[model samples]
Target: MTTTAVDPAKCRRCHRALTSAKSIATGYGPGCAAKIRGAAKTADLTDFKPAQIAKATELIEQGGILRTRRPNLYTAVSGDGNTTYLVARQACTCPAGIKNRACYHRAALTILAAA
Candidate 1:
């Protein structure tokens, strides 16, 4: 399952208590954030639209996409930063996805897999 409202004092990935102010602010520990960034560096955005690619990159860089406890499942923050959606291998639980349309969250998933 994906965690939507993450606690500021815990790591998003491992749910471990976070002591560092930076980690708490970002919702991820230093190591986990580094891993996400490293993965994003290698993601291929050739097939997606420029806007999608840019958004996907931004999600990774800003810690908007978070790995859930389940394999192949993730939680992505909405563009307005007001909501989080569950993303799986084949589908995402976002509005665009609900209508069977594409969304940047899927592209973010591809980026996350590199980690």
Candidate 2:
């Protein structure tokens, strides 16, 4: 009689022990999964909203516009320090800020505008 069993040392990618729990491609035990999940909380996406990310991306891509509500805001940059651009609320001047929705500058701008 033959019994089927999973090899612990086999890695789906390199056929070795998947040391990095981030390798979701190759599944490990539940404990490993849980550990990875805990490590990647923001990426878990249990309540992920694609629309929100899309909207943020759009806002960033559109860039910021100077408005009467918030003065002294910066949008785009130039070699000259005098060349200041007013950024619209929640707008980011970075690609990652637009696509990945991870712009610290945008966040800072928003906070400053709010305050």
- The estimated TM-scores of all candidates read 0.64, 0.26
Candidate 2 per-residue C-alpha lDDT over 40-65 given as tens digits, one digit per residue, 9 for 90 to 100: 33332333245433442233223322
Please report how far candidate 2 places residue 57 from its true position, in Å: 22
lDDT tens readout by residue for model 1, 1-115? 8879865487766778999877877777888888877766667755567688779878866788877789888999999999999998568899988987668898888776766
All-Cα superposition RMSD per candidate: 6.8, 17.2
Q: Cα miss at 108, model 2 (Å)? A: 1.1
Per-model C-alpha lDDT, please?
A: 0.80, 0.40
Which residue pairs come into collision in candidate 1? none
Best by TM-score: 1
Off by over 4 Å in 2: 1-73, 76-86
